[model samples]
Target chain A: MKRGSLYTLAYAAVLGLVCALTLSAVDGFTATRKAANARAEEVRNILTVLGVPVDADAAPQELLRVFEDNVTEEERGTRTFYSYEHSAKGFLRAVRFGGPGLWGRVEGFLCFEEDMRTISAVTFYRQEETPGLGGEISSSAFTDQFEGLSAVGPDGSPGIRVVGDGADDINEVDAISGATMTSDKVEDMLNRTLEEMIGRDGFDG
Target chain B: MARADKQACATCGKGVCDGKGVVTFKDGVWHINPVAVQVLGICSALAVTNRLENSLVMGAALIFVTVGSNLFVSLLRNITPRRIRMIAEVAIIATFVIVFDQVLKAYYWEMSKQLGPYVGLIITNCIVMGRAEAFALSNRPMVSMVDGLANGLGYAAVLAIIGFFRELIGTGGLFGHQLLSEAWYTPNQLAVLAPGAFIALGFLIAIFNAISGANREEGSQR
Candidate 1:
């Protein structure tokens, strides 16, 4: 073997070994922490959507505690949703959802009122839209508008719409001014997910 | 070998305290500052400086990667072949970047989300490669490490200043805290966006150049 080629091979081998070792070590060490964080975030999101008063800076333990005390996971047939009993109302349901966003998948939890028809809140957990534009889908200014809006009409049709701001429709929420595509996609996501939920045996009233 | 000789040695020690690596420290910290003096690694400055928290984290990440890659590059300087040294340097730089990325994702999950694609983009950051090529490739490991750290700080300092103004004015807050009274002051919405970053960075760069220029003149006088 040529001397330089031999050096190159040695360099490549050592570099590969070192890189693999470092990456694997980090991955192993962080795997549990990452999982715990994801779980805590999910718990927090569920609580937020359910209107279960969670401090934004609450510890993970506190979040888990709140989630356990207030929320219950209900399974019917092959579908599952988080349920919380309201004092005045019957029960609220929340489902985790994900769909195509402008840049990537947008994922969040959508909560419903006791009737399972009115959207109580919507919280996006992950989105890849533009930060100031399409990214506003995650913003409360946009998501908050979905509150008290009907997810389904009187005839059981999906009536949710992402309309321009200030249009007179009870079923429509304002689209983010510059994020028309993201708003439309979010509307599509909600309608599609709600339709699927309605088709399931447990979701039908 | 008497009392006078001992006293003389003590004074000399104090006078020459800058010793071996002090010049490297000085170079990294101020005179040859990576961001201010060399004008490298401005992408993260623009992207992360919208918020102080993001800038601080980005700075620390840059420091970790830069110092790590510099040390490794300097260590392997002798053995690395001329033809493929860039490739070797990139491998080392990328390994550190990924390690930093994984650590952030694991520990500071929210921050990882906020930073989004910037952490992974560290491998492409010009400052890391710039330091490795210019200093680490020729220097000893210790010096290179110092250079790396100094450059990271320089970059971080600039980002922090930019973030301070952007967050304070754009959002009427600091680190998302509502410092400005809402009823009195309204936020400049433009400050939170990309074009705002460009304008803020431009003025900051101008101020930095003026200060650095003055420092240069003072150093020349000395």
Candidate 2:
């Protein structure tokens, strides 16, 4: 029985430890900043929904400042301000809107001011839509139209319509040229969210 | 005679390239195809084919990882013990995967986001390991390098074709810009979805299989 020495195991253990430490350090070095960058990216996306110009390259501090000045948060049901520095505000201006998608949950954040009739910014947290088509909803072209779009209907209804071109309503953003289903789904989700915030729901999940 | 060296050994499937420049055109055309022909390295193939830009990034990333992994594994084959070879191969491959991942993040941050987790998933791709053990372990570094390049090209060829269709049809655009006359048909948004990837992949696989079969028949005639 010509058994090899413990050297092989020693070699493997050392090698494994080195790899683990290196990977962990790489992850650690980036994790906090990535998290903060992600948060900033969210803020920037929210600002885009408000139709404000976003420089993703800007410092997160500057981005946060821009977000603070432009889009104040409102509570879910009460339209209470949720801006961080505003100690008296009751809730965050942004609320999460989500529902089932073709692949998984289609969730986005909607940031608004004290008046919930306008959507200051929108950013989807998760979606598995068709990559080029529904996927492009995440694209600037698609999401950009959402800026300046009204959250409430002209009749002062709490919901918005996903309509084709020619809707005279200020709240209506034209449907994506080919992605009608995904477009409708986002519109429907927002409408349901509005309904929930207005106390129309029997219960909030 | 060549027949004498062909004696069946206990490790029959392990009769890898014997470092004698035994690489051939068949390796390129079919035997080691990164996709349907070899049925290897497909997870990333499906995920990153949505946009041409992302697909190209994924392709380049894989090429770098595969070739680097192959070179290192082949170079280290002699010193490695037979028992722990798998671990050795993985360590070598993972090293390259990390470097590839970091380079993408540093240089192509936007494409990296669009690709999502698929960049990391390259580590798990069977073809990279498959080539490492099957060819690289036994072949010289230069030929092993070619094997890696060929396999990557095979995969990229399929991916680019798929990307072209997925981008053009799915978004009514190509490479992130509009190209189609919207009047013909609204973007077949369905094509950009995951199911579209599967459908397109299946057709492309069929087309390749057919061409390969025809080529085989022609060779027999010749």
Which tens-of-lDDT digit does each residue in A1-205 have in candidate 2? 2337586787678667867777677766656656666677677665554445667577777988888786666554553333432233222256677787656679777765545556656678679887667877677776666555677777877777778774578887767767788888888888888777654442222
- Tens-place lDDT per residue, model 1, A128-196, is 898888888878888878788888765668658888867466677778888889988998988888887
Q: How high is each candidate's TM-score? A: 0.88, 0.66
Two-chain complex of model 2, DockQ on C-alpha atoms against the true structure = 0.16
Off by over 4 Å in 1: A76-78, A154-156, B1-20, B214-222
Model 2 residue A70 lDDT? 63
Error of 2 at B8 (Å): 22
Query: Can you tell me the CAPRI class of model 1?
Result: medium
Determine the iRMS, in angstroms, of model 1. 1.2
> Highest TM-score: which candidate?
1
